[model samples]
Target: MSWKLQSVYMGMTDVATHNVLLLLKSVMRQCANIELNEGGNLLQHSLWVAYQAQAAGCESPLVVAALFHDIGHCLCAGDPELPDYYRDREHAALAATWLSRWFPASVCAPVAMHIDAKRYLATVDPAYRMQLGRGSKQSLENQGGLMTEHELSAFSSHRQHEQALLVRVFDDAPYVGECLPPYTRYERIVRSVMR
Candidate 1:
């Protein structure tokens, strides 16, 4: 899709917020290469994840997090430097950190832990470990398993674990229909959360 980000602040309350949106727009313009499955695009992938997060009963913060989880891909230029790709881990932490001012920790927590959660799952569940994609597996092998108690402790403390898992599940869920339909879903989720 043509990533023509209309340079409009619409309802943005402050300059900082407007700037962040501009940043997103700029990144979208540059990241035309990202493609989602079956004629889908990065925008669709983002919206779908947010849509499903709302449908799956995720709260507002989590829903928002789902929507912007991959925004960092545009800014950081494809997944921030991390130790593992074995589980398709990326720059979730960096994204989460940047989002902190705009969103609550409850929201950013899952976004931040998205990568570590994959690593945690890999270590705890062999079945899950087996299902990881090639990129994930390669990263896991290269990074080795979640081998420290501190890492395990950190993953455990994240209150967004369940929500993060929900986001993860939908992130890869089948996109069976037109992407336009999901936009409404995303809107509804965001509205519900904001309420």
Candidate 2:
């Protein structure tokens, strides 16, 4: 692993937090080279959700969470196989943990629990399940289907539960967005939030 990443895993110094304004610029720059299946763009999707959070006046941390929520996809990029991320339920956790190195739990927790938020929504809202795209559906199956009673109860009481659910709402948005402004636009937010 790269020294930076290894340091992070070893609980070294890192910071991962910021606001929506900078989100637009940073995400555009960050995601410019990123793309996903179909016509989806990872940064586009992330920015869309982050923008939504911003438009709704969500907290800066949540906006940042929305912006990098699926970073795991990039982290696991180029795997010829399905990757072991799913077998261990590490998809969101991977992103969250990595971000945790640089960010506080306020930001990482929502990213970490986004998938569980999906499962939570599917279990509580039948229409939500029906609306899930094929990929999401497959992932849900891979994520152990709907939340069991115990899982649901535990999730509902989580410290970041509300924020995580909000992140999911943004995550489900269609993958389409314009390039962000500029990284400097919100650099202060990131600097202030970093550990």
Candidate 3:
């Protein structure tokens, strides 16, 4: 199915929250079969990340960013034109572009920078690169391996750099079999912060 995000968000001034939630629920349900690392399926990983964000005492926007950070994977999976590696290299941009319509830069900026955050961490923390999952390791190669000193310096200057790094921590953590609340647990939190 062609997912027209604009159509989904159109003409609802005050109800962007509800509409965005519905859009997220629809995507999650439709993409339930897609695996996201050994951590689990897409929904499971998102929930775990979001749970970690909340547990870390993140504000609502950061929690939402964690929940939706990898949504571009699902979007790319549905597209026949995009290659697999494109999903890895471009998913963050895809998700951030779509989410920018409804969320402030505080939320979307970190989502956009998540892939770079991984690369940054890999460069700064040698052990971080070793701990990556098979998929992430492969994607790291596609995402330009480790960041160069110049790239690292530029990425560090972004206002949301710290938030992006925090999200990256949750992204790399193994969530499967760990105790995490159900996806439903964050519905209210997501709704409250939407738009």
Candidate 4:
């Protein structure tokens, strides 16, 4: 069965473990409803980050952040029937702020800074700036994504910032077919983090 936050929240884990995966799974389900480009699902995005994290030798907190970074977008993409601009300014901050109430600093810190991680790469990594989708680039220039130097500096110091950076990076990677990686991956991550 598809995982739900409420189920895991009431499961055997303590508050800390429950909250992290609960929040992640909630976002995962929300994102699952979104098309990852044309015919893709957001669950693949989460799995991709988890696989990428392990390949890069990352540990628990960063790995966890990688798995849940874009969760905010799924949670707060706003009503589909509403106008595009009829939404919050920063999904990252919204996710982070909500996460801050329960997760460890290592996890929430990167969730909070994931947007800036994108901004910093855009500024410092010319190739990265070039690779952004038209909408993402537009968001960077016109929306609040372009980080001030101070914000960039502050974000650079956070733990697992690199992993968050990877999340931001892979988020734009070619959309694998919807459910390409299957539900099992998401299930494992959710179960693992919760336990």
lDDT of 1 by residue, 1-195 (tens): 233433344333346555655665556555456663345676777777777776778768887888877665655655446333422344576677776765677777777766666677777778988887665566566544564778877667767787777666676566767444434344444333331
Of the pair 2 and 3, which is ahead by lDDT? 3
Instruction: Choose 3 or 4, whichever is better by lDDT.
Output: 3
lDDT of each: 0.64, 0.75, 0.84, 0.65
- State the displacement of the C-alpha of residue 100, model 4, in Å, after optimal TM-score superposition: 2.9
TM-score, candidate number 3: 0.87
All candidates: TM-score: 0.68, 0.76, 0.87, 0.70
Q: Give the per-residue Cα lDDT of candidate 3 at 71.
A: 84
What's the ranking of the predictions by TM-score, best on top?
3, 2, 4, 1
Better of 2 and 4 by lDDT: 2
Tens-place lDDT per residue, model 2, 160-190, is: 9999999998878774545654335445555
User: Per-residue lDDT for 49-163 in model 4, tens only?
Assistant: 6666656777666666777776666776655764443232466676777766655767666776767777888877889888787777766764466667887787788766776
Q: TM-score winner among the candidates?
A: 3
lDDT of 4: 0.65
Candidate 4 wrong stretches, greater than 4 Å: 1-27, 78-89, 175-195
Candidate no. 1 TM-score:
0.68
Q: Report the candidate with higher lDDT, 1 versus 4.
A: 4
**Clash number by candidate, in order:** 7, 6, 0, 0
C-alpha root-mean-square deviation, each candidate = 8.1, 7.6, 6.4, 6.8
